[model samples]
Target: MAEFTVNATRFDPYKNFKFRVKWDGKYVAGISKVTSLKRTTEVVKHRHGGDPSTSRKSPGRTEFEAVTLSRGVTHDVEFERWANKVWNYGSGLGAETSLKDFRKDIIIEVYNEAGQLAQAYKVFRCWVSEFESLPELDANANAVAIQTIKLENEGWERDYSVAEPTEPSFVEP
Candidate 1:
């Protein structure tokens, strides 16, 4: 004889491809790939002469990796305009200044099978840091043109206020 075990709660799986990206309160298009949505923190250590063998470790500064957004080149010049908001040449045409109206926060959402928000990554004070220049073209070749832009953000955090994606379970066709 054998006993079966199963949790009463249901679960749903989410795919990475099914994600939505929003910036400056607007949805951006032409995106093909995303990378480096990870963060790291520094640690500090302290110890006393009479203390135990180990030292005390405390969390220090947190650093967020620069996010890279890859996409195919398009007719839209939104990316360049977005970068100008961060630091653009002054109208005087010499010095560069930050545009008060340009900087904005970004949010990326992942959706589950039910089309529900699974996870959200909120990037604070995000700005376009770098965008690759136009790529070279050949006389005879068959391929899609693609470009990648990198973003430098002050900080980012997973909105734990939101629930995690549902767990995977049996589903009927």
Candidate 2:
């Protein structure tokens, strides 16, 4: 397994951000999320095995294997035009005074045993908050910060498809 970091910047609110993951030179998974945080670290796990207990006839033994393609990390993230304007007030305006809500979407994809796209999952998070003595732009920064942390801390995983070989025919002479 191999690990890699994806940096997201110059975000576009209408467009979705995507990240492709490969293992052992094969497409393993992909992730897409709305651009928000300055950076996000993604950890992916790849493995194969089965449980004997689940089967009527145990295989006698069970095998477990896993590879960590990446570790905990933080990458730089940039916000889209609308999101940036909503968060930062670099134009010398006072901080945001009222609380606001922001929504972010994330997508995860994984392949099946036949080397085909098997599954995809979509998740979302919302941020809301109120601040005192806060400028209009900064009022929601705290909410966004909290939402970002929650998403990163959450563990993400997806299982690959299982393929079985067909039996061959035998002819007697």
Candidate 3:
């Protein structure tokens, strides 16, 4: 008889609770949430002059809503730097609306426990719409400091390749 040895490994469902975010690949930061969607379609109808009115439909322009990404406030001045570069602080509409002030996209890469990419999404033509207000701080309260970043992007698409787990045998989250 020949002797054989065996190794046992446990397979657990993947977790996507933790994730990292990037701002046009320039700055990498922690992300809490990112949500946005295309504008709803408006229904239009056309009626005949004399007889009963016929039905007609038309689709409105494709518009994107503002996306909000919440995260723990960074200790550095990265936020300030980015805002200054993208948004005009001084008076004038020129600063607020300029092609030179917008970023190409914002990417979010979610990883598994093994540091493997679980899912990813890229938001295109993102520009800072709002910095969002900072939460109140109290000496007596015990809580983590968090802030949200609002970005208005034209559109977004998911990275299907990255969304699929790299591991050959892994459970979906």
Top candidate by lDDT: 1
Which of candidates 1 and 3 reaches a greater TM-score? 1
Error of 3 at 10 (Å): 16
Q: What is the lDDT of residue 71 in candidate 1?
A: 73
Predicted structure with the largest TM-score when compared to the true one: 1
Give the lDDT ranking, best first: 1, 3, 2
Report model 3's TM-score to 2 decimal places: 0.66
TM-score ranking, best first: 1, 3, 2
Backbone atom clashes (below 3 Å) for every candidate: 2, 14, 0
Model 2 spans > 4 angstroms off: 1-86, 89-101, 113-115, 126-173
What does the lDDT read for residue 113 in candidate 2?
A: 33
Clashes of 1: 2
Worst lDDT run of 10 residues, candidate 2, spans 64-73
Among all windows of 10 consecutive residues in model 3, the one with the lowest summed lDDT is 1-10
| Cα error, candidate 2, residue 169 (Å) | 17
Positional deviation of 102 in candidate 1, in angstroms?
3.7
